[model samples]
Target: MDGFDETFDWVVVGSGAGSMTSALVMRQAGKSVLVLEKTGYVGGTTAKSGGVIWVPNNPLMRQAGEQDSTEAGIAYLEALAENLPGSTPEKRRAYVVESQKMIDFLLAQGIPLARGADFWPDYYDEVPGGCKTSRTVTARYFNKAELGPEWAARLRPGFVSQPAMLSEGLKLAWVGRSWKIKLLLLRIGLRVIAGKLTGKQWVSAGAALQGRLLKAVLDAGADVRIDSPVRELVIADGRVAGVIAESGGERRRIGARLGVLINAGGFAQNQAMRDRFMPGTRAEWSNTPEGDTGDMHAEMERIGAALGQMDQMVGYQMTRMPGWEQAFVKPPAQSLTGKPGAILVDQSGQRYMNEGGSYELYCQTMFERNRTVPAIPSWAIFDARFAQSYPIAGVRMAKMHQVWKDSGYLKEADTIEGLAAQIGVPAEALQATIARWNGFVDAGHDADFGRGARAYDQWLGDPFLKPNPALARIDQAPFYAVDVVPGDVSTYGGAVTDARARVLRPDGSVIDGLYACGVSSASVMGGVYVGAGASIGPSLAFGYVAARHAAGLDNSL
Candidate 1:
């Protein structure tokens, strides 16, 4: 302790959900824990996301009578993972087994948990052992008052700041079609009104999730420091022992007797890193907060931690609108492009891939197509039917501003050929593509790419559609096009670690006393995103695993 300004049994860098979870685990073991966050906010990128956790055989799912097994979960992961780097058979098994335990622990601690919509399908539900009924879980709505005014103000806000649960938020897509959705809207309205009278600050999604975790950590007596950025991991006797961090406008050395865990997030905001690894992507297209600049990634690498899957990201396709950079939520094109009466086309006005699959695969295909075609800024062609029936980037089609057209964010024309001219694609090619799409709609089958063939694809489509939910004739007048870019919620690659969450060297040797989880560690799902909350699920699982190992306990089933 003499070599440090202060010391704790465990030091967690970053205030992401996983970091808070690890802190709770340490405190539950009666060990001292310190959480150092670089920003004034307590929650990291996890707070801004959907906050869904993908867990197979979770207690919430079992309570809801949803059936799942550890073997089936492992099979599902193994089917997709398939020897991909950063994911192993053992790691996959650990994720399936320990994630359930982690969720159980959180629930036992009184954290409000709920199962995601039963209709929500896994990204690759067609894969072996994949569940058509969702295995996702989310935190219920939490009032910020639970953390008191001081701590509540520091909780990071989500893109959807509305207090609606994630399930309620999904119902917005069926607004005019479903009677249940109408009822849900009425309920949401009343809730909003009640909040206006009660002075209660409610949050849902990622904000609710991290808020609950932060509360648990605080209640367990863990120390959390905001605006404290760890600059270096102090090594004593060739092992991570402490950290040199900036605290209260001064650099302070803080020691960790047990170990140091890095959950500090990925390098989504660092343009240089993006260019080096993901050459086609841009930092401007990222949805993560500016604090996710990959400082911990560089530090870990410098200290001999092997990095893997450096080019991967959680692709979340987004459409740019006026002032998109400043907007809390950029208009999402993931669902819109998959809906009836709309199809995505490259610069040459050619449809290349299935448009109604997972957003990750959609963006990956966009990049893959860009290798030979200019598809980075692809065109999403839609007709008046789609425009009138659905919302674009949360704005009703009738409410669209003339400024959007003037700024070229939304292009419109009375005919397909005219719309093609506006977007600088060949008129004939555009005409041919639309005709082919209309033919597919009539046939009730997408022979080209099978857009609506999967349950997951149809979930994103309009259920009211007859033949195929994801297919409709795009022959209506007043065609429109918008720029769809490969935006991301966060980078997916980072420091390589073993199944126990211990950082590993290139030669498979462990870095003693150093661990990583969340996006700071190489993803456990490999290159493919397995489900709705695959990112956060493994983060929580590995966090629990790391803490249990540090406590000299076994986490594996």
Candidate 2:
């Protein structure tokens, strides 16, 4: 403390969902809090994401008349985390118990949160103790103008920036088919017009959630700074005491009397770290913001924090498009390939894994398939019927950009064989694969991989399709193809923390006064994603745990 330029009761690094939650917790405890963000924006990758928080037994669910219990939630997590390296029994129980408390705290502080769609089933709804009715939560739409100009401009944008809620936005894909969806679009359009007239900038999804959290943190009088990156963690008396960081082109040593919490995200933007930990993936394919470069990861490792699950990522399949490097949201192919009348095949025109399932498992399968075959860039083959009925990469098939074909991102042909030839796959093999898929459609069941067998898989499929929503004949003419890569939402790896969110050493001893959450720590859900917002829910929960621990408060409301 003698050499420190400034001091605070708690110092939090990286302004993602967890960072904001921890800051609010400390502030509520009457402790001085400082939140440092590496990027100019206050929200990290959370801002660009869907911002769904998968909290089991949350108040929103209870209020909605959905039945859930802490024991049931723990059972589901145990099933998912069984034999996984990054999770422990204590951590799993703590996540289920503390998640509701965290949400309650947010509500008490007046954060606008509500339950997501009841139809949005858990990714593994068929698993024991899984809530098929859904346990996801999201923030209500927020007007950025509420944050004032400076803060509003600094809030990172989400993929879906419209004023509509996420539940309404999901129906957008079926707008062409449903009159209900068309009317919903009209409502959203009117909402946007109203915002424009009132000089209000409304944002939805992740941006909306982060905006509400940021507003609360600012209102609580927490000192928040951007463009301030922590370079090193300073240790005193064999514990973390402060951080050496840079701000306004000046280096400063800031001490945390209680502790320093790192929620700075993972190395999804760091190619070197990806090559070292996850070898089969490319950093460019990740949708995480550039600030996810793992600077704090290296710093934490230098301080003897044990890193685990470096090989895992929140896999989100995508197809590259024109200007993809600068695109706000990468062209998602997760739902596209799983929709009716579409199927994914390897380079040899062979169908491997089930085309419909969790996107995390989908990309994991891509890497796994690549180990034995050329599946890194698989082919998503679809027919004209699908083209006319659905959208690809946010553009309807009839209105696909010319640059898509010019850039070799899209391939079209009058026949299945012709499309296969164009994509450099064996025509005969492609034809046989399509024939087999069509047979499955006729029989109303997938014998090979059980495509629509699960509730989650059907949710990813076309809801309008009959029999099996995930299965359809791919026999129509004018077939098309696009290259699908194992893109990622964020890398799922980092310093291992205990149940209390304390960074731990390799020997299972805690790094005194040091905490980590979000992507900065190994995922609490292990390698499997149980539902949407699994990452965000644990992040906020652990962040709350970290702050309460730092403030010498117990885990109670």
Candidate 3:
């Protein structure tokens, strides 16, 4: 062991959005900070996510003339989170009161934001307090070159870049739509190609926001060390004073006189943890990297730090390539662009939820149903027309014939009974399920599970179709069945803390010099995600709050 003393005003563990946000806030306050990242690169799961920040009643919404009030937002979240046992009135109120301030703070830092995507709907639009107006906001496009060579190398590669450029946007849209979306997509394509030819790398949305924040942190002269996992938190006099970090095959203590913040993400990659905490899950993660091992959770628990929302996690049950654990599943859009082609079913051949529901709802439903039945390997059965029209997991079904066959993911047959036989289901049961589904499509109604039922569920459907794109009848021939396993973006449970972002002891007293944010702490949303970007939004907000508080600034915007 080598002995080295490197001191900073604040020491932050993890380089994810939350940790970086806190570090940047402190740096802006003219405080010297040291950030320790466990992975080889910066940007935790956030880099790989859809980076829209879902803050209701933000400045962008106001500018767009979308009527939103803090009270309404609060009410809506309260209603949505009411189902979860961990949700508390205090957390919900805190989220609403501080959300606008967090948005304003980011905007002040030269981060531009666009209006919430109007096309995307809130998860529960039918519920009261839901707003049709866009509240999600993202940064203006950023160029990777702006970060300089050294910083760019530290960022994770192969992550989604921004600006919704032509190439990527078109490909994403093509996942579930027909050629009718071509013109809207072609315009984006032209801009992307033009930017590339002109030596400009325009990034937008999550990528842009993350890039800007990273650049700002680096610009403020904060030192970031990659591949340095914090092994332990040194507590003295009931306060976190510093950390013992393992990096470069050596261990050393880095002390922070002011405070130590833990933002080291959730335990998505820890298969054992997932199996224990989140039962029946396949533990397939499409996260940024594989280094997130819940080191913070273990280290904090060892010191008697209280844990919150331990049973909940952000579930993303997508289809994946067999044996290739990291790939996410895409929706079924092949033959059903203009007609219904496939249906999602549990082992009992019964519909459980709308197939078009966001990954959160899908995973929740899977887990909920798995409690009583075998939902580990659900099936998405479709027809040959769907195979021809839309792509599965981003590849045209025809193109992936070899891969699917080799991987045992593709099950095909000329008749429904044959397909059921291959899928190990009762032939009569599956046929009956399909027959009932066809009736619902023909009558333009979904009585039984309400497929294409709600406005929210139909938001992502193909606009070219007369009825709901997500509600096509699966009556066509050459039936197909692809398996969907339980997956996730990250775990949601972790160390317990308050609105001020100070970590609390199990007895409810604040750990004076310790702060925690991101998935390293229980979510303020109380385990019910409202929309896209909810995970990282609170992560960044609380990080700012924690840093400001640690720097002795009043948490007043």
Candidate 4:
């Protein structure tokens, strides 16, 4: 590293939502900001996401005549942070309260945000103070022409990246909604034609979210160095004053006048960290970017930055095809498990949970099951009929039997017993689990687990199908089985911070000139997934706070 006297008012590590948003805010405040990214491009997991930011009571919701009160949102937050040691009322209140103001600042910088959906329910709609809508916000489809091809090509894709509206993509993904899908496709076609005529491509979801942040940073003249990673934070006079960054295998010392904000994401890619902090996680099943090694967490911890929430992660049981690496290759685990005709079972071939639960519950259950039994990598067993209705890992495009067999990811047999033997589970037990599931399907109720009892689960499945679309029989021949692992959306555990986004020590002392956000910091929800966009939304809010505080500006906004 060479410390050739490069300095800035603020230095931020990582190029994810938290880091980028913080940089944008500081730059907009007329402060020189330097963004250091480990990867060759910008945007981390935020790019490969739905980009929904949960703003409890933004103006967009009010304009639509549906505004959730701060009191209600705070009530929800209080319930969420109940048992969480690191989740404080101050942090939760800070997020839900300043959400609108932080959004206003970003919107002024041309963030292109809008209310995510009129009905994108909180993941925990059943939780107290939770609302069906008026809490989620995201970047609407934005023209990539603003970034041009250079930066545009660097934008990563996750889930849906075609720049269509989030609502439209949700409709298209719902295979059962044929008419709605057609309408959305027609609208998309028109947009594509219009984009072609105007010489532009579009990005949406996570890509758009991070893209907008990056654009704001660039437009405000902030310096962002790609392929440069901060290996260590520089402490000067008991304060974080600079960072040692690596660029092209050479080290450079960049000084920060204000502080060092670490938004480098979590340790989802770090197996040793996973084994140490999050034993329930597996490196292969992670959905975060490969660059997310959680190295910064340990680095900060060595400097006395207290770590908490090490036991929390957000994930869904997911499938991996022959070439697919991350579990996010298909519809999320909730969609797969909640749908009818599939039963998730442990090594003993016994059903473990209500298949119609949310993704967060899936991770929590997998962790609990692994405690008593070897259930980290479970199996999803179904029949040919299920394949006809829904395809696992997009198997419909290829020959399901041949491709899955060749890949060794899918086991198929003419009978349940044979399938069980192929997968190496108890034959009788497998057969019994399926039989019980079928009985529940026929009875039009999940007698044992109540799979389709929740409105959320039912909404994910085909509403018009039979008694309960999430309950179906697996009696058809050519039954299939695939391994489903506890794949995380991201690790939600790490260095602890306060509502002002200031890092804390074990002795309850603030680490001056140091801050953290995103999964790099312990979540405000205390590792709980309250709804879609929970992580991204709070990341931006606190990152914004970290920037304002570092810049000596009023954080009350």
Best by lDDT: 2
Ranking by lDDT: 2, 1, 4, 3
Q: What lDDT would each prediction earn against the true structure?
A: 0.89, 0.90, 0.73, 0.80
Tens digits of per-residue lDDT, candidate 2, 155-243, equal 99887767889989988888888999999999999999988999888898999999999999999999999999999999999999999
Off by over 4 Å in 3: 1-4, 82-86, 161-184, 201-205, 285-288, 326-340, 555-557
What does candidate 3's lDDT look like per residue over 1-557, in tens digits? 12336778899998877777787788888999999988877777776565667777877778777888998888889878853322467766776767678788878877666654665667666667776545676666678688888777777643455346222452455544556456656666777788788776666645666677788888889988988888889877667888888899999888897899999888777778777777655445435358767878888888888888877777765665555553432232222221246677788776676666556777788878878877767888888777776666556777678788777778889998899888888888898988988888788877876767656666656556676666677767888888776566778888888878788887888888888888899888876878767888788878888888889886553
TM-score: model 2 vs. ground truth: 0.98
| Model 1 spans > 4 angstroms off | 555-557
Q: Which ten residues in a row have the lowest lDDT in candidate 2?
A: 77-86
Structure candidate 4, residue pairs in collision: 1-251, 1-252, 2-251, 123-531
- Residue 360 miss distance in model 1 (angstroms): 1.4
Per-residue lDDT of candidate 1, residues 474-528 (tens digit): 9788889999999988899999888899999999998999999999998889788
Compare candidates 1 and 2 on lDDT and give the better one: 2
Clashes of 2: 0
Residue 48's lDDT within candidate 4 is: 84
- How much RMSD separates candidate 3 from the native structure? 3.3
In candidate 3, position 525 carries an lDDT of 81
For model 1, the local distance difference test gives 0.89
Each model's TM-score, in the order given?
A: 0.98, 0.98, 0.91, 0.92
